[model samples]
Target: MAARRRRDNVLVAVLAVLAVLGGGRTILGWFSTPPPGPSDDTTTKIVGRSQLAESFARDFVVTYLSASANQQDKIAEYVSSGQQVTLPSTGRQVSDPAVVFAEREVSNPQLEVWSVTISAKVGKGAGTAVGTSSSAAASTASSSGTTTSASNASATAGPGRQYYRVAVSVAAGRVRALSLPAAVDAPGRGSDLALANQNSCSPDTPFGQVVSGFLTAYLTGSGDLSRYTVPNSGMVAPAPAPFVSVETATVSTDTTGCGTGGGTARVLATVNPKATDGASPTLAYPLTMIFSAGQWQVQRIDPLPPLRNPLTVVVGDATQGPQVQSTPSSVATTSPSSAVQVPPAKQN
Candidate 1:
């Protein structure tokens, strides 16, 4: 009888332990859920892409019209990575997410549909984060580059509506190709401002009074800019940066029944203002004008187009095709000795 009792006690203790372990396992199972899914970040390897390039372009256009200088800088980062962007409109690799949010304020402008192509050049250690430090490493490593060309519809709907496309090209994981503003064309011609002005101001309107009225309306943003644009609002020449004095003005003369579309004598407005660029007062800059609807309207002003240099091509291979030394056959060349040939070379 003693032996049997001992055996029973041992069996009971073993059963209890088993019961505890089973219960613990049950509880753990009830509380635990499956492991969380993998994250969305996929770009880990180096590669070239077209879609990523489109995203960069879309972001750039949005940044161009931004009023806040700071917001613009954040958007600039994707293009240039090193510069310390101080102005809201200048910077690189910005961190602010809310900066690009205000693009909803302005309506997307009417944009033409065009093709955009991007080529990718990715070397090992060639990211903006370490570009300055490891530039040589990136340049020396066996570089893999790809060129991706794609066609996308770039449209601006009316004054503020713009559409963009995003594409992706992958080699290993990183984006290495991109294109921008590949093509541009207006779907339709904009309304003619000259025709629209015929229904508005007139030659009888005094030039000074008109200028003053326009200035006041623009500074306050009160008048309808859709009808008339102001240089102060960044719409016209003579950007309203350095304020100048108005020296004199001449009323416009209307010439009716001379030509079709109601021709009018081109008016003239002369003003001698102090130069912000250190030009002399005797310069007497003459602003070309047109008299329409009995008012003198500015047509053109003095200022050359912004300077742009020709692109420099660096040949990568000596085994490539021979360089052509001959000029294009289409170019008509006369004797270089002529006294400064005028543009078009007085065709025939």
Candidate 2:
């Protein structure tokens, strides 16, 4: 009996030791692992629209303006150089990537939430133009396939519409392509122009209203965005152009690879000014939107016509009757395009 009681006490001591060790491990894991709940902040970095816009502008200038071979070779960094870009003189022909970058102008910066309707047709057209590239060609056939090469290349590219949303991200003050959200398919609009006039064209007929709702939800963290989708199915529609907007325009969507990774939507109608009395002008082009987190968000607004900077020109003749000599004008010929390096907005 004595021996048995001694053995029982030893067993109890071993079990208690095991429990303490196990509990220590569990506590360590609790401390090391991330909590199983929503994070305080999901954005990698929170920044204001002005800072984001200015950063985008600076990157646009540097990528397009830098002179070294580094700048020249860097063309592939933003866009595939082999792809087609409009020449200044020719309409839409494949040209040097540098030339297209050269035309990039980052002025009259405006960032806001507004509704935009993307035409499926225009999306298809841009995709078609981009679909026929050598890189896409290389997808199929060993580097040496001959007769079936081009067609095979197109096939290897996968369907152009599969990638509905073009993901854009700004890192270290430079804009680069990023991963897109999951849902990217827009129910086919089927080449209809008149449909644009009706709210059924999308959740909001005015389109800007839809965009406003999106911005309200995304920027201000208010409002629900379930209806902004293409089919109103509660799923977000993919948009091709996430970063750039064209003027009031018609777009074709039948071609492949227009907005490649992001689905493409074309501009089929013109937008009149939304703010009639504001100092800022109205939208001249259609908008492109991306579906994210169960709602469509405006990623690109249409490019407006260039606004002329206010000038103060004085008409004076140096050769007038009064004895006068020509003096250099006080107005500087080259002023800074924009103030360099506005600090990023301070975070709380």
Candidate 3:
């Protein structure tokens, strides 16, 4: 009887230990957190799509506007079958078709579309019709008299500024469709004044003196500009003139659009260039002045009514290949005698 009771007690103790372990596991399972599942970030995906769209739009515009027969052939590769490529028959030449902005109009896993708007200078020139300019005689002989007159009319049309819109579509990492280019209105000019920041400089201080001195040097192309401009300022000295005449000089404490101040000021100066032959046209200078090395210096000279898009590509006739022209830093106004204040330099 004693041996049997000891065996029973050992069995009961083993059962209790197993029950305790099982219960502990069950409790832990109820409170423990599961590992996180995979997540997809949509922001990164959207940004990537935008970049792709912009690149496609830029390339399409450049290629479509190309006068080269080789470039025209490349356009078909970017679009699907049966898509119409309606190019100007008169061979409209465009310069500086820069994309000011672009955005995605439609997005999907299988297909994406983008709308790109650009600013360009559009012009028409002689001998831009299909085929070589030397073929003018051949065209005249093959076509009717009216056709020749039409060609002449096209040749006489001058160039004008215009904005354009292009639509691009992508699928499976390839351009699948493209829309015909269309003309659109340009965006309105934005405010020229920059927001007030720590870099602001007063117009009457050394900054002003620096601006005046720099303008004097710039107009006459002869002055001690070292005391008034930073080294490597890229300020081009005007060619020597018989005399420099300043009709107006307006100084502003507002750096608004010029740039961040190390020491900078904006000066709107109306200058009259008097040459030995006669009185030259009056020009305006929207000057940005910077202070450096214990003196205020000229930093940058902005074109009046700043260019909307600086990266403009000039497309020449068939004989001439496409050429890229940098936006002019200084612009001459059409009005010879206008008291227009220089707009402030914008923040980059």
Best by TM-score: 3
What is the C-alpha local distance difference test score of each model? 0.31, 0.33, 0.53
Q: How big is the RMSD of model 3?
A: 17.2
Pairwise TM-score winner, candidates 2 and 3: 3
| Per-residue lDDT of candidate 3, residues 1-348 (tens digit) | 999999999999999999999999999989989766534676776667767766777666656665454345676766654665555544456554456567778877888888887554445542243322223222333332322333553454444335568887867666644766677765554333221121223334444445555666666655555545567776667565445553334343344423233455555555556655667656666666555554455667766522223223333321111333433333322221212122233244
TM-scores for every candidate against the unseen true structure:
0.19, 0.19, 0.39
Candidate 2 stretches greater than 4 Å from native: 1-22, 27-77, 80-164, 167-170, 178-348
- For model 1 the local lDDT of residue 189 reads 27
Compared with the true structure, what per-residue lDDT tens digits does model 2 show for residues 1-348?
Answer: 999999999999999999999999999988796777634452323333334533443333333333234343444565446644332221221211110111222322331321111111112233333334443333222222422345644664333312122233444445543221122343332221121211112222333344444433333233343444343444332332122222222221221222222343432233322222432222233455553543333445446321112312223422222333332333211222222111122243
* Candidate 1 local Cα displacement, residue 217, angstroms: 10
Please give the RMSD of candidate 1 to the true structure.
25.5
